[model samples]
Every structure is written in C-alpha cells, then in structure tokens.
Target: MTLPTTAAAPPSAPPRTFSAVLVANRGEIACRVIRTLKEMGIRSVAVYSDADKDAKHVALADTAVAIGGTAPAESYLKIDAIIDACRRSGAEAVHPGYGFLSENVEFAKALDAAGITFIGPGIGAIEVMGDKIRSKNHVMAYDVPCVPGIAKPGLTDQDLIEAASDVGFPLLIKPSAGGGGKGMHVVEQAEDLASTLLTARRVAASAFGDDTLFLERLIRAPRHIEVQVLADNHGNVIHLGERECSLQRRHQKVIEEAPSALFESLADGAAHRERIGEAACNAARSVNYSGAGTVEFLVSDEHPDEFFFMEMNTRLQVEHPVTELVTGIDLVEWQVRIAAGEVLTVAQSDVVLQGHAVEARVYAEVPERNFMPSMGRIVALAEHGAADATVSGQQPDHANVRIDSAMRDTLQITGDYDPMLAKVIAWGEGRTAALDTLDAALGRYTLLGVDTNVEYLRLLINDSDVRAGHLDTGLIERKLPSMEFRHAGPRELIAAALTLWLERPGSAFAGDAWKVPDAWRVGARGAWTATFGLPGAGTATVSVTEKDGSVTAAVDGGGPVNVRVADRSGTGLVLEFDGGLVTYAVGSAPGAVREISVGNDGWSCRLEVLDRAERLRRMLSGIQREEGAADPEVRSPMPGTVVSVSVSDGDSVEEGQVLLAVEAMKMEHQLVASVAGTVHLTSKPGDLVKADQILATIHVHVATEETANTGQNTDKEVHP
Candidate 1:
C-alpha cells in the first residue's frame, strides 16, 4: 500500500536543525535511537536513573545525565526530570524511544511549550490515537475498517449492556484508555456481561486513569497484523508493508515478521496487502500523523482477506528493525529528518519490499515455568555481533542479522522494569531462509547467570505449524502441552560439579573422609562428590575422580564416564567427554553464591551447588514428607512486590486457592495454596519479595501413630 503524495502542507516555517538530541528512554531502544543520532552526526544525550548509571546507553552517549531514582515513576516516567536533562545537556530535540513517555500528549505539549522539538507525531495525533476507544472510532471516518461492536468515549456499563445484544455474544470488553491486553475480557454470554464490564471499568480507571469501556466482537482465531506507516508534516505518507505478530503468550508478542505470511496465504494475497496497507495510511492521515507509526489490526485467521482496525501506536515499535530490514529504510533517521521539516523524498512507488525479515524478542524469563521473569547480573553476554559491539552498546546491523540490545558484561538485570533484554532480527531471500537465520542467531546468543527463554524460542520457531505459517492467537497455548522443554541433564550436572570442583583449593586431594575413605588410596584417587540443585528438576550428586591428570565423572552414582576440559575461557568451555568434543557456554555466581549456569545447543540451565546443610535439609524433607503430597510452602515465582493477599493468617483454605499476587517486571503472578489447610502469611501487599521466597504456608494436619488407629488428626508446627 502506498500513500498519495498529495495533501495540504502545514504553514511554511523556518527549518529547524538539531545539533543535539536526547533519548528519553532506556535499554535497547535508547541504544537504538542513539546509534542513528550518532550516524547522523547529532550529538546524543542519554538520561539514566540510579539503577542505570552504569547502563550501556549511558556509556554510549556523548554525555549522560542523572534524572532521579531507580524505579520508573521516580525516573523514566518523570517528565520534568527528562526535560531538565534535555535543557542541561543542551539537547534541542528529544526522541522518546517507544515506551516510557513516547506517546504522552502532556509530554509533547510541554516540549512544544519549551520550544523543544519532539521526534514524533503532532500533539493532536497523540492525544486522539493514544486512547484506544477514540482511535477506533476516529479511524472509521477515514474509511478504515473496525472490529464491530460499541465504541464511544463515555459508554457506561448500562450503555454497553443495552448495546450488548446487537454487539452479539462472544464479545470482548476492552478499556479504551490503555493497551497491553490489560482491562480486557471476553464474554461468551449476555448474562456475564455486566460483571465483566464492572471489572473492566475498574481496571481501566486504575491502570489508565480512565473508566471508559468498549465492546467488540471477538474474532475467532485472530491474527495480529500491524502496518508501518511513515508520515511527514507535508501530509505525505507511505507504508513499509505489514508484519505478522500472532505468536504471543499472555498477550505479549514473542515473534514478529514482515511481510506477513498470513497475508501471503490468501487467494488474493497482494490485494489483501494493498487494502490493509491503505487502511493503515488512512488511519495515520486521519490524525495528521507524523514520524514513524504503526497501525495494528486484527485479521481473522479463518478469513484472511478481512482486517479490522485495532489501535495506532504513535511512536516507534519494538519490532521496527524488521520493517527497516525489508524496506532498506532506517525509521529513526526519517523520524529525525521529518522532525527537521524535511519533505518526503521517497515516494510510494519507491517503497519496495526487499527480501524477508523476522525478529524474535529476547526476554529474561523461564519459559517452562509459565514464562516467569528471571533477574540476575549478566556474568556473561554474547550476541549476534562482534564482541566489542556489546561493550559499545551500538546497534549491530550485520549482513543478515540486526541486533538491538543494551546488554553488556556484568550488567545487573533487575525486576524493576520490563523483562525484554534484546531483539534478534534476521533477513534472507525468503521467509524460510530468514527464519533459519533467526534460529541460528538465537542459538549463538548467550546471556548467562540468569534464566532466559532462548531455548524455548528455538522450539517455537521449529514448531511444525509455525514453520508452515499456520499461526493464530491461540497457537502458543494449544501447543504448550506438547512442547518438550529442556532442563539440566546428566551432562549438565557433571559440568556444574566439575566447574566448582576444579576451582576449589586442593582439588587433587579434596574429599570428605567419612563419605569417601577410599578417595586417598595410592592406586586410584578417591571419589569427590558435589550436590547440585537444578531449577525445577530437583537435586543430584555428581562424583568426579581424577588420576594422572585425567578426569572421569558420574552423576547419581551412575557408571563413570571419561571427562576432561580441553580448554577454558571466559564463559566458554571446550570439553572432551565420552568420546565427543563440545563447546559449552557457562557462567558462575560471584563470590560464594555457589550457583553455576551452563548451556550448549541453546538448551541452558542455572544450577546451584548446595552446601552440606542445605543438602541435609533436603534429605530430611524427603524422608519425612508423605507420599504424593504437595509442598506446604508457597513460594514466589519471581522477585516482585506483593500486590494483594487474599488469605489472612489462620484462614482455612482449599487446594488451589489464590493466596496472594506478586507483580514483577510488569507482570502479576498469583500464588496458590497447594493443599486444603489453615494458611499462614509471610509477605503482605506492597512488600518486596525475592524469587523463591516463601510468601505463605498451608498447614495440613497429619495423623499420629496412635491417632491413626482411632482415625484422629493432629497438628504439628513447622517453620522456615
């Protein structure tokens, strides 16, 4: 789809030249924006919170300014702090890179009042399109197709309920004020509409400060497709084609690509693209949109030709690199050029879709555990770029792959923000080639000392339906049951024990006398053993025997297998084991933390070497616990702030009852009681809890020996 190069221009004004620009964001996006500013010879200014003082973006900028505290509200979300930094650094323009305050109308207004340029759309556009309800209603007037239902600025619960019949069953209730799938509910019957609407409104008011609600017919097996449109102050707009974003979990996109494979599957694929692309341009034109924007749509997987308007993002997208790769256009550069009052030099016809591009978002999460966010210091970091690129914090635009990241060696990944670590984008002559490159790139991507979904992403891309382009919103959920997730195996256990054992003092003679009295025999070395606890997979004993500079190891008392370290480097291990040579990526916790991370062939795990006391505690627990009983203690899945506590101390609860909720990395996880019993609370609402910290405990009664004969139950106390 192409934009007509004819429209009324804005009032003629003096061209503005920007010598310095401030990136009002953090992480990979901040680094990405800075790269373009550097290439354009514009001095880049970066702002940081206390947590980000040593961040890669701060180091890459010519000058860095400290804004405020560590949390987003105290720093990144503070408009005044950012504006002050812009003034202090003499930054003439500010680029709000995607998240924080990118589409904030108030921020844009303040910048305009301060005579500073905003490298994005006009105030009117952001103000209107920022609201989901307003954008949906507003776009329809411009010949944009919309999901059928009721959309009004001030629709009350009664108003929506009255219109529910016409909107039909299986409708969706969405908060008009915010995105991210928050405050959205799907109602299958009219009877359930009222209560769901109430919940939606409350969430909307709390999350977005607006209680506005709207209803839309829930499209069955929907595919998320977004179009990248570029518009200037001169009313000229051109599209860069469409991207398929259906592969998601918890309503967050995991994989994205352009041009859409979903669209390409249609009988009239090119015509469908033209229609959707033109609609996207119309949506932008309706708001007089400027700079780079993405118009997202919901297309039915069952019917590929039809698309309904979703929402308009008035800033750069996280998946913008794929659009850039396929079209050979740098969106950031054009954003700057458009902000500087430059006219559109590239016409609609000139926009050619070249090759194919796919992007995978890298998140610090454990996919097997419901995508739980993981946090740790980056003991090791490697990406699809030269080793130096990680240190420089530059966007790596390789021949086939482009990496957008702010990761560096020793960086602390905290739960104070979103868990997205980076993005890996790959390009090729076709979708298959592009996907192959992406899978290979992800395999080489190494970020240790923390759990990540790298291995899960590999499995996802290789899925048969995914490879066949049979994508839908429900695909990931339906496929989750059959997905075989990897964990720490015998080989992993050997590596973990060997890593710690070799680094210990006097390893040649180190052995517990009582446990292995024969370890000191003259003919053979005594067996040295270390206990390691694997994440989710329980514990194991790895015994290593060394004689004459040769090493042999066994896990869980299995037969000894020959093993030797061929080479060792920073986070790199080359080992000859069981007649095979392999390169394994590894990381260890600093100091006496006793944790080690090992990975090879994209499957990785962080295992902890338990001390004597912890190992004994586990052994005692195994001996005392009842058969087939769930653990009494409920642990927080990740480090987060307690958001709610449903059960109070001494409250009787049923199995699987929600006890509390913890919010970490912008996601909320509910902790549940594992058994029917009296509940005891540990952490309350607003209390910060660490990962695996016990938040509550359910005390179930056990029958005593004498009571068992009479069928009487008694309580016994246990403490952490």
Candidate 2:
C-alpha cells in the first residue's frame, strides 16, 4: 500500500470511497463525528454498550450494534467487537473519537490488520506520540522545548525520588500512555513522593493498562495552551492556532477558549502566535503526523514567549468545538478526508481566526464538594443562546452558541464512564462579548434530576477576574471558596406550597381548579400548615389561609406575605409570592414523589409531601436518626467497585485514616474515618457497592487503650 509522499499529491485514480464509518467510541464526540459523517453523505454505524442502548448517538446513526457490557473494557475498548460490528454493518472506516481506544495503538494495529482505515495518524505516529516519554524524545529533534524532568518509563520509587530532587519540588508524576488528567499527580514535598507515585502508577495501570510513569517539572502558574494541527497524507500540515485551557479542576479542563487571552497580553502577540503555530507544525512534521491532532504546551503566564512542549494528543480534543467556531473548519471532516488520501485545501497563510470563542464543559458533578462526579438520570434540560444572542439591542454579531451533547431528558448518566454530560460553546467578536454570550447561554441552560455544575459555571462566567482575562490552571480551585451553593429561596418555597395545595383531591380546586379563583380553601379563610421537604436540606413549613381572591402565607414561621394565583394546572403552577411572580414545572410519577422546577432561577427540587401525622412521626424518629448519627459508619459516596481496603474488621483506626478507596467514573475516591475508633469492615476490595452503601462501621466505644493513642475524647460526637 503506497502512501502520499509529497505536499500536493495528485488525486487518486479511482477516488477512494468511504460509504460508511463506524464510530468506535461513545458520548459527545461520537455524536459529533456522526454529524460530520451525515454532512458528508456517509452512513454511520454506532456501537453501544448495554447501558447505552437508548443513547442519543445510537439513535442518530443509520445503524447500531450492541458490543457488550457497561464497562469500557468489555465494550468500547474491545477491538475484536468493534471490528466485528464494522464487518456486520459494512463500515469501511473506524473513527476513534478520543478516550477509550482513541490513543490505543493496539486497536489501531488491529484495524490495520482487518483492512479498515483508521481515521487518525498511522501506526508510526501513534507509536511515537501515544507514549508521553516517547513523544518527548521524538520532538526534541525538531527543537521543541520540553519540560525539564526525567522521561524514563517504569522508574522505581527511589529513582523517581532522585529525579524529583533534580527537577526540584512541586513537580508532576504523570502516566506516559494516556492523557485526560487521569493518573496524574503533583508532588509538593520529597517525603510525599513515594506514596503519590504508587497511587499514580496504580491509577495509570487501572485506567490505561500501563503503569509506566514520567516525571516533569511543574510550571507553578503556567497557562495550558495547545495548538491544533491538521495534517493530510500529502504532507500538508497547517495549524489552526491555539486554545487556552488554563481553567482546570483536578487537572481536567473546565473551560477552554480559542486565541488565548494570554497572547492578547503580549506586545509582539502576532509574531509570538505565528512562532507557536510554526512550532506545532514542526512537531507534527517530526513524526510525519497525519489527520487532526493537538500539540499541547505549558506557556509561562508571566513570559508569553516562553513555552514548553507538554505532549501530543493523537486524537481530537474535547475542546475542538471552540476551535471550529473560530476557524470555521470542521476537523472531523478533515480527518475523514485526510484518511481518504485528500490534500489540504486551506494553506497555513490562508487560515484565519474570525472571532473569540469559549467552551464550558457541562458535567454531572458537584462543584462545592470537591467536584465529585454525580450520576443519575437527567429528568429535564433546557438550553438557550444557540445561534448567538442579539446583545445590547444591536444587530446580532455573527457570533453564535453551540451545544454538543449526548444527553437528553430522562437519560441516565451512568457511572461507567466520564461524567461530562455536554459541551456549551459560544462565539463573539471580542472576549467580553463572547463571555457575555456564554453567561446568557449558561443562565438559560438548566439540567435537573442529577446534580450539575450549571450554576457553578454561570458563576464562573460572571466572575470579574475571569472577565478580566486573569486565568491559570488553578483558577477554579482558588475561586471555589467564594462560589456559594444556592438553595430553594422564597419563590421556590411558595411554588412548592402552591403545588401541594393544587394536588389535594379533597380541596375545592382539585377538579375544576382553574374556574375557582380561591378554591384552595381551608374552611373559608381557615389557616392550615403543610410541611414541605427540601432536597438536601430540612423541611420548610408553609402556613396558608385563603381569603378574598388571595391567600396569606408564611414560610418557616416567617412574617406573613400575600400570595395570589397567577395560573394553575394539573402539571404546573404560576403564583405571585410577595408581589414577585414565579412558575414551577411540576412532575409526578406513580409514587408520591414530586419534582418541582422554579422558573425564576432554575432551582429544581424533588420534594416528598409530609402530612401532619407523617411530620410528627419523622420528628419523633429523629431521636433514632441521631443515635445512628452519633456512631457513624463510613459509606461509599458513589456507586463503584471497591478498589482497596486499608482496614481490617478488627483494626484500630485513627480519625482521618483512609478506610478504603472506591473507583467510580474513571476516578478514585478515598473514604476516611471521621472519628477515632475500631473499624468493622463490611465490604472488601473488589466488592461492588452502591451509592451511600455502608462499607465499614467505626465503633467509638471500643475498649482498646491502643486506639486512644491520641488521648482525644472517645465520647460520641455528631458525625460530620
């Protein structure tokens, strides 16, 4: 099989055809690839795990194939199954859309052996750039400056310590085989190096099937900037400029923007930008790289000209939409065209960036509690600012907003894979306009059922420092303390009360609720109190009394306020509470559970109605709950497999000691004891546990002098 060896090769004799392509991955990227395939008039073959039978990507494709189970190892990562699905579906090409098998060289080799075109770089490039250590070594010949550290793979802990000592403190221990912030750690002290390395190696081995580690000097406040390079088989390699990915949490990027603001701060910004692009093209040329790839760098925030090569992503990045918005190039389409022996149409000099663009990754996670991955069904979702917003009453800027997501209403966000639910991208003429469009877009975006970081992203977009272009890798972590979690306010409380009132079958407003103006009567102006439960917090008692065409209400023993019905329905209600109107989208299942979403702030809560008797019962049972709370049992925070157990059934443990580690959503969470006690283990390593399942019980009353080494009080305290 001959390949193109020149920069502008002549067209092939027959013009190779790709009638159908199999997306060997899932989630947003798969959908993204499928969309491009549709535009190119090619059939799309989607493969899914058992968990994704009803996924949006599967439904969007022309045909679908069931691979295997929910775990990626049994499904998307299985080369044999993917190839079989391709053979059955008549797919001529396989597009590994990032993650899973995207960077897996073995999968590429298998596809090559099966006579399938892999829509990425060839075997040599994959082998060279897929490994971080190897990529660093290869790029050195092209004058690509790399971070100063050891690149030796599979180094011993002692060797790593010595290397760290040479690299200085605050260095990073990263896996060589993969990216995506997995299996990466920062070592701040020499003493903590060994344990951190061990854990890093463990995560790398589990996540990527390789434990090979690499050491690099940490750039304390460097901005993460990566240049997107597109290469064709005809030796055409051009860069689409850089994407600023500094705002990160746990080393994973939360927000990314094209034409980095850091460059905007530079005096010779255009010259520096062209220099970086040339360097990226040089990096791509180093390995005869083909298809769409990213060359990441850690640019000094203080010195814009100083940058170091990080690593080459051999696949499309999660933040590619932002680049497409700015450059007007469909990278996915280019990947396919390049694989089919097409020459690059746009030259490096002709490529131009039109406007600023920003992309915020919407995730199923909690921002306040350390960004723990939240999983469950998304009951509702509403998005806006799509096609750009007309801001300041001016003619709409050519800027626009786009949402790339694999999520839909009632889609369960399983813990089997990544927690990113969607990507919301916005574009405008300038940074301020782009950010303002992003803010409006996020304000209109609402996701319910599982917890999301929508509100947190909104806060981040509105942040003054963020607006001022002050960004770093640690920006999210530094500002996290100031980002507060909001709850159901007065409007939500009033809506909840109104919903309950309308649901009562015995009330006069039950059947003909719309006709009766004040039919939610409690014996004609009689006052009644109903306790409504708040999600994640205690209940609020709403006392209401119907009067002439209106109602007087007091929430949680607060001062009485006038309330009037703006509108009423069986499934929803709009009420004016304290002269402010709010609407609630109400949903109820077969059970007594009700979901209420407030329109004012998009605050949605799942409430359980408590009658007077049930309220009294719960209050009385609080004593029993308090008793259980006094002697706390450590539980799994999410549904996952128990990776390791640090304590035995009769082991004496100190407070803050790690009881066990749980692996969920491609990350590890260590569960620690809150009190000093003797632990009784209920589950062992490799045991599967559901969310909130008790994993171990720590008894504070254990009669062991050794357990009281700290001399702290053993008296029961309320569990935090």
Candidate 3:
C-alpha cells in the first residue's frame, strides 16, 4: 500500500481553520477533545447513542447529533453515520476519540477519502501499528528493545506447544491482532499451555475476528511503563518522558503516574530516562508517525535497566493527563497543529519533568464483584475544593492536584460504553506528596446511586505495597482477597442512627412541625425505630428513644447507647455519641431533611430523604433472590450467541459437563449441566439467547423410588 505523502501548502490556498469538529466517540475522551476545540475558538459537535442522548458530553458540546442505536457498533462505530453527521452539521473535521475507531486504519482512510481531515495519526501509521505482529516487527526494525517473542503467522496447536516450550514456562500467549490485554493469557506451566492457547484463540477470534496467537517470555514482577511521543508532518519527533501504569486489574490500567517511582529508584535515573526516551523516539521516526502516540514497555522490577516493547497506541492515551500535568503541554492542541503542516516547536532538550503526577481512573464498576461494570443513574457528585492543602507532606498548591471529569449528577451510566466516569489527578514535588494529595482528594470525593471504584482507588494508594511502589498487573487480583472497604466509625454510625430516627414516620416533628416552635415537645421525649439504607453498604436498623432531657438509641440487635445532641446557634443539630459525630442542619424546615455526618476518621457523609416510597422501593429492590429456585433446565447466564451445542435431546451427559458455550463481551462462558442427566437441547449453534433462557432440559436418571419423589418435587417446583 502506497502511503499518502504530506501535502505542501499551495500559494493560492489559505490555511483552513476548522469551525467545528464532530467527535466520533463517547465518554470522557469525547469530552476531553471538545474542551480543546472550545478553547481554540472552534465549535464542537457531539454524536451520541440512544443511551447517551442526555449525557454530559452531549450537553457540553455546541451541538449534538443522534447517530443510531445504543450499542457502539450501531452508533459510534458506524462510519457512514458519523460522516453524515459531520456533513449535516457543517463539521470540517472528524475526531475519532480513542477506542471505537480512533486507531482503525480503515476509518482513517475513509476520512481521508471523504476529504475530512482525521484528527489523529495518518492511515499508514495506524495500519502499521494496528496489527500487533506488524507493530512488533516495525519497532524491532528500529532496534527498539522488545520482549523476546514470535510474531510469525500460522502456528498449529503442536507448533504453539513447541514454541511455548522453547520460550519456557511462565510465558504469555497474546493475539497478534489484539490490544488492551484482550485475547491474552499467561501460562505458568507446560501443562497449562494447551488450555491457555485454546482460551486465547477463542477470545481473539471473538474480539478481533482473528484467532492467530503469539508467544512471549513473561517478565516476572514487571512494571508497565510507556513513553509519550509526538511527531509532525515535517519529520520532527520528540519524547515526553514516561508514565507508570503499574496499577492494574486483569491487565487493564486503573491508575497511572508520570515519572514513575521505579524510575527514581534507579541508581542512574537520568541516564535510564534518556535511553528509554531515545528508543521511543527511534520507534516513532521509523514509522514516520505523527500526532500524539504512546510506546508501551514492560520494565523488570529487579533490573530496571531492562525493558521490552509491549505495543504502540497510535493516539492520545486515557492517562495522557498525567503527562500533561507534568509537561504543561496540551497534546490535543499539538495533534491539531501538527496535522496542519506545522513543525514541532518543543525539542527533546526543551521537555522538562516538573513534578510527580498521579491519575486514578474512577470507573463505574463494582470492585467487590470482579470490577464488573455498574450501570445506573448518577444521583450526586461531590468533590473537594482544590486549594493550597498539605497532604502526605506535599502541598497540593505546590504539587498541583487536578480533577478531569465529564460527568454530572443527571447523567445515566449505561453498559453500552466504557465504565469510566472521571480521571482524578494529583501532583506533588515527590512521590509521597503526590500519593498523599491524591488520597486526600479521593476521600473528599463522593458519588451516589451508582457504585464507583473510588473507595477501592483510595485503598490502593494507601496500601503498603502501592505506597512502596511494588506494583504489577496482578496487584489488584493478589490483594483483592485481603481488601476491605473503609468503614464509618462509631461516631458516624451513632449520628446516622439519630438522624434517621429523628426523621422517622412517627417522629414528633412530622411534616413541617419543625417550622412551628409550638410543635416542639416542651419537655416530652420522642422515640422511633427506623431502617437506614446504605446502598452498597448493608442496611442498619436502629431505635432512637428520646427523653425530655436526653436521647438514647440502640442499633438493631445491639446494646443501647446514650446520644448527645448539641444545638449549633444557626447551623443545626450536632449529634455526638459513641465514637461517631454527625451534624444535621435541616434548618427549621418542616419538609424532607438533609443531614450531614462526619466520622472521627475524617470520612464525612450526608444523607437526604428524597422520597419515602421511592427510597423504600429501591431498598427492597436491591435484595436479589438466590438462583430463582434452581430449575432443572440449563439456562444462559448472560445475553450472548450460542457458539456450539455439545449435546442433543435425550443424550446422556455427566455432571459438570459443558452443554453449550455462549460468548459475551469477548469472553466465552460455558453453560454446563449441574447434574448428570439426559440432555434435551432446545437451542442450536449460532442461536442468540437472552439471560435465563432455558437452553436445554436435563431429565435425571434414578431408581423407581427416587424417580417418583423427584417427579413430585419437580412438578411442585415448576408449577410454583
């Protein structure tokens, strides 16, 4: 394929400044790009799916276009829809924000063919780096040190086994066409090679539509490091130091830090940075790359001198903000300028590392449930004030803590997009200061209704291993079993109990009674018992008994405790009892009350009664029944397409046997028989199944007495 040469400026043609650019992506990245365009005096166009019609990014954009259905493939990934949106909206350029089509070679080519400048690397660069095998070979050609691996095509099962043996145990099987850790597996022993290969192939085939796999030697206790590179059409390229993305879950980065602690630990830190930077520059120059790109490497923990190339992301990365914080450069602006036939203004010598910066990706996910994406309405968002604050011995004003978000209280978080809600970044003169500021900022941050990984991120920064920078891709999994949520102390608990009790249905101050001083109990004590729902946290029911002079409360199934209520002149009621203290400042209002509670541990909280019926409905709905009575028929656990049905009607199968396989989210889940029985297949291969669909029936074989009893129980259960 012949690459398009950089066009020279025509004497008669004027430099065209785009009036508006259509963001062909969703979520934070879309918002990030729009912010840059707005700053540059350019109008921004947003495209959204049915699920994101009212999203924050859509509202923030100058104009919005409804693309199509909710799924990415139908909306954001639809090239024609995006192009039409640009044409209809008078958008001059199309910015495919990372993910959907950001690095897609065909997408870039289509944009070029349509005479729309794609705000990213050229199609040639994207094509060269989009394929893992091709990118690996290209990087190696530049003498860029890479992980010893095979990128050759067409490897049979036996060939892969032999290659795995040659690479030795503890190797990685990765798809040559995949990235983001998808279609990747780690084999710890020779016996696990075959299974790992099958799994990797299956996932790769499903995700990238390519089943070819490659092998690489696994680096033990490796830290993920990547150097940011920017290139111009004028053959100018430079490196922007490195960011440490060691904190990960299932190979997905959760937190990233610039000027890694691992780098500082080296005896020759300055020399090592220069070496890595040069290699990264060479890799970019080899591809004649343009715009913002990231060259990732896996650095050895024991030997910091050794590093290997992982892959090259041909666009701005999710954690690019960390680099921006330290370098003080707007990568998006540079990408636009460079694409406009501009020269690189900043040289390698001009690039300076200012301070330590850390960024935590706040994802809408349940950490307790293996980080599954959580979808729901965002009820509230609270963030701490960014001011001069000393944390972890570093002053934020001096270190600089920044919060970049594209979320508002009214937006709905749906599963159709990436689960990330925001990126919280903190900078400090040193590692301790940076981490400390981030931790403090995280503690003050709050999101309600939908579960977030904020609490988990807080725990991770405070963890002993993370604090010491002993991190790897497997850190989350290894430490998850021992991880626990930070709990509200006794003082906070007591205050919460008192607040809920005071706001109970039968309380003395019922519906505007607080506004009438005459309604106050001259010397009467009021008491009530109520349940307080904690959402993700389990509920706690408490009984509050008030006397003429004092109030006493007892938590459900617990001992009684005295409560001290202090009246703050105009603030509200401050309840102090047990080890917790909370302040309820509802004023003299007679309607719903909003209460604030502060634990002695520094985790402050607020509770508000929005609607009684709605709250009750939600609280009751949160409780899920166990297994729905366990029907004898095997059902699909999630929405997916059946790949193959292994059994037919009346075929005898053993317990724990695979009945069929369903693929969802690029992972294959096997629907297996719980008991040995004759299978009655109802769904065939390639059939689309919804969650809880009865794929097959299992008729158990038993003795005469057992059969009679089983039949009776089955009839009752099925009928009930």
Give the candidate number with the greatest TM-score: 1
Better lDDT candidate (2, 3): 2
TM-score for all predictions?
Answer: 0.92, 0.90, 0.79
Worst 10 residues of 3 by lDDT: 385-394
Native-vs-model 3 lDDT? Answer: 0.73
Task: Go through the candidates in order and give each one's C-alpha lDDT.
Answer: 0.84, 0.80, 0.73
lDDT of 2 by residue, 6-123 (tens): 3444666645769999999898888888988888899999999999999989998999999999988899988999999999999999999999898888989999999999999988
**TM-score for candidate 1:** 0.92
Report RMSD for candidate 1: 3.9
Residues 270-348, model 1: lDDT tens digits = 8888888899998998989999999999998777777899999999988888888788888898999899998767777
Error of 2 at 488 (Å): 1.9
Judging by TM-score, tell me the better candidate of 2 and 3: 2
